[model samples]
Target chain A: MKPSSPLGARFRTAVLTLSLAVVATLGSVSRADVPVREEPQRPSAFGATEDAPLPTVAPGDLQGLLRNCDAERERAVAAQKLCEQDKTGVDFLGAAYAALWIILMAFFALVAIRQRRLSAELATLRERLARLGER
Target chain B: MSASSPDADLQPARPGVTWMPYVVAAALLVALFLVFFVAPRERTMGEVQRIFYFHVASAFAALIGWVGCAVASLAYLFLSARQGMEVIAKITDRLAHALGEIGVLFGTIVLITGPLWAKPVWKTYWTWEPRLVLMMLTQFLFIGYLVLRAYAKKDVAGRKLAAGIAVIGGPAVYLIHVAVELWGGNHPQVVSGQGGGLQHPDMQLTFAVAIASVLLFAASLVHLRMRHHAFTDELEDAYLELSDREDARS
Candidate 1:
């Protein structure tokens, strides 16, 4: 597609950004299963789930496999929890922002009203003085 | 005909005959409509996610004001063209204040709606994560900038002092990202550290468009704000001159 329109460029950028992100996430998981243990490690506790989907690596010792599954599950839960907390903080900040706008607009309107009133009053006084000068 | 001193009232806006305020008000309304109804709701967050439009847009405006402040300050520092730079500084300062106010407002919205959007998925509110922390710090620094400008009187010494702070404050504001990167939290920090992108094609496009629209609105708003500052300054000077005459009569 031509890169002329904003829509096209945005779409292109979005596609690139998304693909990169997916690769990054997948890459982390694939690379993280390092051989930290001297002996060959097995799947995690989550390995108990026969239906569980994981790398197609040949099954290893049952205990190690189970431990690996458990660790993966724990990581997933932790990540989700982190997202939740972040959301809350974002919410708090949002309300604070709205309140500020409300107060600011109200103050602005009030001042405008007050100034208009004073200006009108001053105008009226000037008119009175002009009439006295005519007399 | 407002003769109010620059720092006299820490007030919002006084009564004035001007089209810009209405323009701003109209632009704001248009922005609201376009953002909420026109722009498609997020695929990920759905309807509640609509708040992201104004929330992020306001933040973008603040960013514009920040950049403007830095530029105007620099012009003042380098050129020393008193009238032009001083005028620009005043206008940019006002823009900064206006945007800062809006930023605080939207920043808070991002926080509240953030959980509403997140709770469905994460089932929680509040986090110590880096993104959120950095966002909060950004809000705090703007608030400080506004308060500092207000407290600083309008004078040679005051302008120089404010200019000094602005030089330090401008770049310093972004350091919130650095601070956030230092700690643990689930904020995507790619540019700063964490993979900040969710990596969904649709999400990315929508986000970019949303941000662009908001930037346009801010650019227009700041332009009007700068003009308002110049006229308002002229009006105040006229009033001061009149006030001096009254003093002589008394």
Candidate 2:
């Protein structure tokens, strides 16, 4: 079948392209394991610095560090601070609400515009029919 | 207008000029109040879990819209070919189209809001889980229906074909409803046959309110859309009438 109009054909093509883009993006991102959240402002306690010198640790000292877990406890304390500092969850929540409101309002506006246009078109058609009937 | 003219049955009814809008507005406000202030923060996800109230509610509303579209489309298909049933057939046709459009709208909300909620909770915006895939498929189907309705010829055959699309897309909704149970995806099964997803009383109450409000709002949208369809049909009929008169005079 033919397209209703040139504009309709263009609109359909655009919609199809956008849908494909969305599907491709989703497919590519679904495989990613990394969390989408941004890292906290404070640097993490863990991860070796490229410029830092590696200290040679004695076996006894290594064993003591492993058994006492002093470094692990400090990392945990730092992790708690990092978790508290990160506001990604709250930001996402706000974004979700905003998206919802935006979509709903846009739909309402679309309906309003369609109604106004249709009313005007209908009145025009009826007036033309009245003029024809009078002759 | 003569009884035989297409415009004879095209009188516009102002469905939106009713109490439905006030009720929907009040219900939405109450639901928002319940979701934010009354519902307690979840232990694990904290405040972000609040999105669950509307996310799930939108899914419910979308399903209703799709299922209702299917039913209306079936009626239109059955009635369109019968004699002297043109008015009822037109009504069903308009209803089907309205529901189909509304389904797409709500399904879009589900798709958008789902990812937003998932980004932090699942640590990803989207996953190829069974339920998620099914929901996405449903959205595509309804979107196709709307596109077809918009571009197809304004004739009985075109309407029937559009109705067929809706009818075929109907079963996908049921499959989406059961996808979590069948495939055990990352998507949570909040309301199920076994029942136990929502544990808190406040959560359950907020969810109920949200579902009611969203569903009411969707139904009102469908009603308003049907009125628009009627006006469009009336305009077409007027054009036809004017064209016929001009031909006679010439």
TM-score each candidate.
0.51, 0.79
Q: How far out, in Å, is residue B221 in model 1?
A: 3.0
DockQ of each: 0.03, 0.15
**Top TM-score model:** 2
Question: Residues A1-135, candidate 1, lDDT per residue (tens digit)?
Answer: 844644334435544654576578558757764333222111111111112355444566777778778878876775566455446544543554465467556745754675565455445544543544465
Residues B1-250, model 1: lDDT tens digits: 3343322332233334356456566656665555444554333333444454555555555555655565555555555446556555565555544554444545554555555444443344444455665566555555544445444434444444445545554664465435544664543232232334424344444455656655654555455444444444444454454457456555
- Per-residue error at A40 for model 2, in Å? 22
User: Clash number for model 2?
Assistant: 0
Candidate 2: CAPRI quality band: incorrect
Predicted candidate 2 versus true structure: per-residue lDDT over B18-120, tens digit per residue:
7888999999999999988988765445567778889888888899899999999999999988999989999999999999888888888889988887777
Best model number under lDDT:
2
Name the TM-score of candidate 1: 0.51
Worst 10 residues of 2 chain A by lDDT: A41-50
